[model samples]
Target: MPVIRVEMFKGRTVDQKRQLVKELTDAFIRTCGGTPESVQIVITDVAKEDWGGAGILMSDKYPDKK
Candidate 1:
């Protein structure tokens, strides 16, 4: 089984997530030679306040992004 984990800032629509998983599964199967049924993916959505970079919280770093 191939387990894939993805973490990104939240706010993506459901359709976008669906497309992401489908494309990811297809790419994994094409390159890694795994069946779609055997592929597992986990998506984690983090808020800007919960994620930090450059010694500053993302919320503060990119307030305009919110």
Candidate 2:
């Protein structure tokens, strides 16, 4: 089994996530020769306040976004 973890700011729609997982599974199967059913994908959605970059909170860094 192959496990894939993706962490990103929370705002993506269900369709986007579905497409991402499908494409990821396809790529893994093509490169690693694994069944799509055996591939595990975990997506972690974090709020801008919970994530930090460049020593600053993302929410504070980009106040224009929600």
Candidate 3:
């Protein structure tokens, strides 16, 4: 079995997440010859506020200034 974890900032559509999971699973199946049932995909969507750099949240780290 192969486990693939994807971590990224939040705000993606359901379709986008679905595509990502499908493609990742497909890759594992193609290269590792693993079945979809044997492949585990975990997607973690971290909020921008949970990420920080230099005392600023990623939500605050730009000109848009969320």
The model with the greatest TM-score is 1
Candidate 1 at 18: error in angstroms? 0.1
* TM-score-sorted candidate list, best first: 1, 2, 3
Q: What is the C-alpha RMSD of each candidate to the true structure, in Å?
A: 1.4, 1.3, 2.3
lDDT of 3 by residue, 1-66 (tens): 778889888889999999999999888888889579998988999988788888788877753444
Global lDDT of model 2? 0.93
How accurate locally, in lDDT, is each candidate? Answer: 0.92, 0.93, 0.85
**True lDDT of residue 63, candidate 2:** 77
Task: Summarize candidate 2's per-residue lDDT along 39-64 as a digit string, tens digits.
Answer: 99999999999989889999998775
lDDT of 1 by residue, 3-66 (tens): 9999989989999999999999999999989689999999999999999988999988778532
Q: Which stretches of candidate 2 lie over 4 Å from their true place?
A: none
Q: Once model 1 is optimally superposed onto the true structure by TM-score, how far is the C-alpha of residue 21 displaced, in angstroms? A: 0.2
Which pairs clash in model 1? none
- Give the residue spans of candidate 1 off by over 4 A: 64-66
Per-candidate total of colliding backbone pairs:
0, 0, 0
**TM-scores for every candidate against the unseen true structure:** 0.92, 0.91, 0.77
